[model samples]
Target: MYTLILISTMTNLSEIRALVLPYYEDVALICAIITALPVLVGIILYLSKNHISKPSTPKDAEALVEYKKYFTEKELEKLEVPYVQRIENNIERDVIEEAADFLKSSEQVLIICGESGIGKTKLAIEISIKINESKELTGNFKFKGNCLFANLRHYKNPKDIEEKLNAKLSEKTVLIFDDYQYNMEVFNEIKNKALRRNSKLIITTRPIFVKALKEKIGEVSIRKIKLGRMDINGILKDLEDGDLKKVERISEGNPAIALLALDYIREDPDRNAKEVFQGIRTSKDFFDKIIKDFQKEYGEDFIEFLAEGELTGGVANIPQEYEKTMIEMEKSGHIAKHESKYHLTPDVLSEYLINREFFSGTILKHSFEELARADNGTYILEMLNSIMKIKDDREIYRKAAAKLLEIVDQLEPNAEQKKKRIKTGIMVYDGFGSLNLVTEKLKEFWTDYDILQDGKDLLDLGIFLIKISKPYEARKCLEKAEEIFSKNHDKVGISSTSHSLGIIYQQQGNYEEAVKKYNQSLEMKEELGDKSGIAITLYQLGNIHYSQGNYEEAVKKYNQSLEMNKKPGDKSGIAKTLHQLGMIHHDKGNYEEAVKKYNQSLEIKEELGDKSGIAITLHQLGNIHYSQGNYEEAVKKYNQSLKIKEELGDKSGIAKTLHQLDRIKKDMDRLKEKMGEENFEKAYQKIESNNK
Candidate 1:
């Protein structure tokens, strides 16, 4: 119609132009839409590919929202158990009240000691709240956030926060220094200032810190409160219907473990409580989560630093850059700051880091060498030897031992420090796994060291002989040491000699003599309050019982040792005890229980990267399968064991696994032949029946 109008009206130029313009405009609009379709389609595809679903928010976190301004509520919640104003007749509550009362007393510092997850931080928080609400001091008391929980290192400017702290020292500020175990300079500075300002300094840390604090600050009358587990009956009643008793036993009275169990029960409601409790202890994933958080907050390098320091008996100088991090770690309960050095909190965490790839042979050797160069480095050398004994990493120990030997040899010959370090290394030759090297070093330096001048030298020589598998020589040296210790009235030395002699008797299969000597050692250790020595003697006794097939008695001794081991986070001891338990179960035809215990031991071994330990566990598992008539599974497990043994250069282990594989093959062949005979019999019977 527009065309007709334009054609009809020669003078209708405006109409024609208008129609053309409209047509062009419509075409342009269509072109624009076509172009946009591809772009729109691409954007849609891109969004679909890259999209991530949002995580569901935690409802439990809502309860913590009010304290968000003072802390990262989520982080604080992780650091401590949920707050409780009062638990009737609770031991932890009593400790809190005592600590709070101490804060109001003339005491300048209050030290609270307990194992991790025992509600130390929670107790501190409650005390702070109580003190703050009551205006316990001059002005309205201000509760500073948990010092250990604060990441002062990550702060944009730490000086500003420090200045604010200094400015508020005149006020009724309750500075809660949770888990202070290292950086004595900072601790001393803060302690002095807090005392000068009359501000309350409340500290919560591992029991080891009490010893460390005493070492750092000298004998100050700081009121010490040791937090124990809450009463079991009340906890059971409070938890309502659940395996609270099992939780109590497995968690060993740890509030954190109980809380975690409650969380699991609330989540599934049907999962076995005992199993859930065990999962918390044995699950690698749970440990990984805690370790990841520690690493994220303080960084892996700082963790490495702490681990190396611990290997040296918690002796290390905190770098200026790490000062804030150290404080934050202490506050967070990941580490403890006592004076100038730092120690990791929850000994298990230290064990985890020690077994990590970050603590490689090279790194360990470097740390050892660094300590060897420091003043009183001999103490660190002794500590290294002790750690190496627990680790049993032959290659790692060899490298470190050689380096230490070299360092001591090069030291001003005849120097007391040099002799002391050499003696320390010699005392732990069994741990070093370098009998020939240590022997050579010993011979080369013997005369120069004049080791016979001191009674302790005989102890070192005796330990070296024992490690070298020369029981006869060990007996002679230990007897000499005993004589010297007796003459010198060194009760501790005599006890040590008795322990060394016990090891010799054990090696010689003289169980009676071994037990007698170990008992002597145990009695002395108990008298000296040396829990570690007592644990070692008890474990040795368990070994004797296991060898004699007295499984029940062995378990009793092992359990006692295990309880003591728990205090120090002795993973090696735990794994050894578990492995022994697996052996007992296997001997008793408890295949399922044996498998569980073996798997648990294997997990810890794998974490420690103890290839020999892993192979041993695998072999035991194969034995269990073989007993159960699972030939194929037995073969698989045997092969896995063989592979690891071969990699470890364990000739005896490889040979043992090979023999097992041969046995399995023969068993398989016999099984097939028996099956064939049975099938023939069935065929014959079928034919006879048909014929009839």
Candidate 2:
């Protein structure tokens, strides 16, 4: 058996050798082929690099032509202004820098998300300019390419855009799509092509569109850089200090709006910044397009609900049926959710919606009382102010203003609701600029309700009356409020009412009564430990002393008020005190000291956007120039003050300035009489030369 097994094993071994020996030549050949394969690939790659034709770069003129197709002449002009860099706090990264980094990476797509007018397109343009200039941004790759821009809406159809993109895009090329919306077929095709060609795409769109874009471009290497509103100080940094404050208030950190404001100023160089801002129609088309798109996607009722929510202090109460819709709206960036409540996003949108509702009469369908009782009544006032800006809508605004006041009489005066009624009435009068309507409403309210019972309401109305320069009406309200407060033993109400009365008396030139009211208010404020109230009373007392021609006493009171104001950082109070001090110095013939004080006050008022205060200070400066016989300088300052007063509709202030101008003319005539015509002409020339 062992012999047979050995013989079989040997036979098997012999068969295996016989099978392997014939293929030895073939095995050697396979090994040689494997060893040379890498060398063959290297040779092929080198030959391909040298032989293939490179993409032709367009000349600068041709590039400009292509860019013009995407940007308007006006938009191109805007590029002359350097782009302000925006930084992201969370990542501590410059948005432009991050975008450049993304362009250099393997990421094929970058979506820049922001609200309308938040500078997304401008940022994208800046990023494109950066990438086009810097070869380092492309890792110093040999395939230098152009940066192209297109707004998707500019094309007649998606197919047109797709064809253009396919024809233009190449390796290392950067393409920007401004105001991009997702089209699944077009985007998917372009995305695949971009990946294959090693190109990059940058998309600028409202935040609402980003989610849809992400979903449509599935598995594509994409990054997102969200933009927020520009910093308040960053927008138009070189604007005059007063104009800067106006722009900051009106733009609300929106860089596009800020730029629009700058354009308005350029167009009307002589207008007050406040007037220019009031007349600037924020891109109605942009806001209208957003609303239309939202309505189309979410239905009219849903859009209305969001708008109404915004009008009512930004808290939307979603029902069970609208829960999914609300979530989708939040995802689409039409609304934001906080603590289980949804709010319409981008306050400008809310303002637009309110305006739309006002025009459609949808807002008027709700009683003014009901609207006023909503979480924020200020929206109603803001809406009225917006309407008042439209020159053609004056009649309609007056009608609406009347209707608002009429509704105030209907409001019930329960504890919680009474406060709303008083606030609504004051806001309506303050914002609408209709004194007759307010006066009628006040008379009706006083007759219908027991004014003596609501001391706080009377006090509030009196203060608002004083602000509007209605001294007679303010005196009536304050006296009534003081009587009620005394009867009720409400020291805070008494103090506020006394302070308000002091303001009215001082305005009326009744210095003795003004001092008495101020003392009463000051004593009560001290007892109540109201530091801010005491500062205000001291300032008022200083005004009384100044009017009485007691400069020394006025300075003492003003210094006391100034010290108190500084401790609490009450800039407005400090500014008022400084202005009074300047007036005293001016009367004492201390021109230099007076100018210094007035300028300090003016700076603070400009920073605060206090047009009324600014006008007053400017008028005082004009007085100093007049006293110094600098006729040209005085007229310049007076006209500057007059322009602001006119813009503010301060009739009394305007009258005062016009009177000063008349006095300046008379003074010039008197000089002409004292000095003969030729001598007067020579003197005027000399003054002009000195001024130069």
Candidate 3:
């Protein structure tokens, strides 16, 4: 094409050359403009097309993203399960099954109740699924109805929840009325809707509310399936990867508590529920330990408040004394002290305590044959040794404690049962320290967490030991514990056990092992929607790195942990982790950083009156002063710590203060020697003046 153009140009030669040269420039410029036209047009079309076809975000997607910007997938999933996992084992199960049956029969308003976490919504889900499957099987071309689940907690109006459910129910004709525990108005509305639409209504609620409704509305036509003991097979299935004893021990014949048991045991098929019970018992005792410690600060008032039950229609504050007592207990952390009233954190904890005490032949509930050999009578005497120590118990408290102890002494503890018994014993003693005399009788089992013999028990008991400074023993206990959860079919248990093992490893010197265990724990936590647990593990992993002198690694771990912790309102744990981080900074000579950590810890301690923890920070501050050669200041801190230790009668704390005081003295002497008598006297005087 160039040659042809050149040839054409040459045709005009000679005289045409001058005309061609000027004309050629003009023609060439025109050609360049023409060539650029297609490219420019193509670029404009591409930009216009991009603008026209830009992706559009659906309203749901945008709203969902915005809602989730502050939450995690694990946290968001919580909104899906409206059931609290409470209620008696068989009662809850039967209710759910019956709810399904009634729904299948197109009965409207299947009422649900009998305590929190009763698997009400869970049963509703099951009922819905049953209906759905039956519809699919109906030889009908299409099932035009759909299933609806709505929680009353999220809505001020049951009508609104009904509206939402209706949108979905119209498609499947099955509606789940959850949180029916108190919202009778909403319950009746759903009942009416179910009747009108010829749809099924599976109502989940507490019997108190149901009774109230029955009384008010005059016995509405609905199936009254009381949720009680879960199906035994279902219990085992939930504990599929766990043990029978665990289902037995933690569950205590109630499927409700068994759900939490899934948070602890890593069951092996070779091991039955009885074996997993070992894990459950340990977790129960561990939690009891925490509660009892809080109880000590607040007194037994909280326990009673917690045990007193939360069903307002059934129970109310008796008088000024009980109310005051409840407030005190709440302050001490035994109860969630909201609005100056108390409720057990959840019904599950109460049931765990009650069932573990009375029904099943757990060590706590066992007949003490070994003691009876000496004299079962003497064992009751021994049990009273501790029961006599608790402050401000009404007759009911003493009677309850004594009876529970009598049961404990009479039973023969299998290794697993023995471990649980020992754990409960330790918890009792620890909770009511005035009962140290009783601890001596149970001394053989004091450190017998090891004797419990399960992977989860060993690991968790090991972590507990670390806090109390029984490192060598803790290490030994955790040593027997496995790294990964047993490849048991109980997937839920596996995750919890894995997390326990990770925590143990983290406490030990093996950081790599710790990380590995933590990762496994994290995976399990994620699968289970346990954000609080995950955050705690992450923080712990960071601490492991900090211990190994990896500050950056520690910070990263802490940040990750904090992010998760904040979502769950785990303030106490968050404060503690921040304290560790401050230490890392202080060790690195980052005084500001260190101060930040201690300050955060200090704030929480102040709010909590965590005297024992406050002692630790005061001690740290003294060290920080000593590091800067401020001997007088160090001594002042040491004195402050000593004062607290004295107030609390904390032997270990007293020892710490003594150590700090000795160091301060030595530093003062060295400073005196370095400056010489005359100048040092002047320097000491200056220090004294500044200190004043």
Best by lDDT: 2
Residue-by-residue lDDT tens digits, candidate 2, 1-692: 00000000000122223334546666576557657786575655565489633332211212211344655555567544677656321123477567657645677677776655676666655655654676344344322555565433323244545545656653345565433232233445555666566555666665555665677666777787777556556646677877776676566566766777777767876787556554543245333545555555567776666666654556556777778887665653456666666665543343444435544544235544466545434455544443343322123345555665555455555554445455656665555444456667645343322333577777777787677666777778778888988998999999998888888878888888878888998999999988888999998888777777888888999999999999888999999889989988888899999999999999787655576798899999999999898888787778878977876677888899999888976776799999999989886775444332
Listed in order, each prediction's TM-score against the native is 0.43, 0.52, 0.40
Q: How far is candidate 2 from the true structure (C-alpha RMSD, Å)?
A: 21.1
- The whole-model lDDT of each prediction reads 0.60, 0.62, 0.52
Looking at candidate 1, the ten consecutive residues that score lowest on lDDT are 1-10
lDDT of 1 by residue, 1-692 (tens): 00000000001122224324655676576567658786575655555468623222211221111122334445465644446533422323555547546644666556666655666666655555554455342233333332222212122232324554565454433454322332334445556655555454556666644555656545456666666556555554676534665565456556666666666666776767556755565345334544554555567777667666776668477788888987666653457555666666534343354334223432234554566667645555645543553443323344455666666655655467556655655654545333455645544343333345566777777676665466776687788789889998898999899999999999999989999999999998889988777777888899899999898999999889989988877777778778888998999998889899998888777555566677888899999988887666677778778877765556777799889877866775575577787774564454333222
- The candidate, 1 or 2, that scores higher on lDDT is 2
Better of 1 and 3 by lDDT: 1
lDDT of 3 by residue, 460-492 (tens): 666556555576776676555643335434455
Model 3 TM-score, 2 decimals: 0.40
Better of 1 and 2 by TM-score: 2
- Please tell me which predicted candidate would have the highest TM-score against the true structure: 2
Backbone clash total for model 3 is: 49
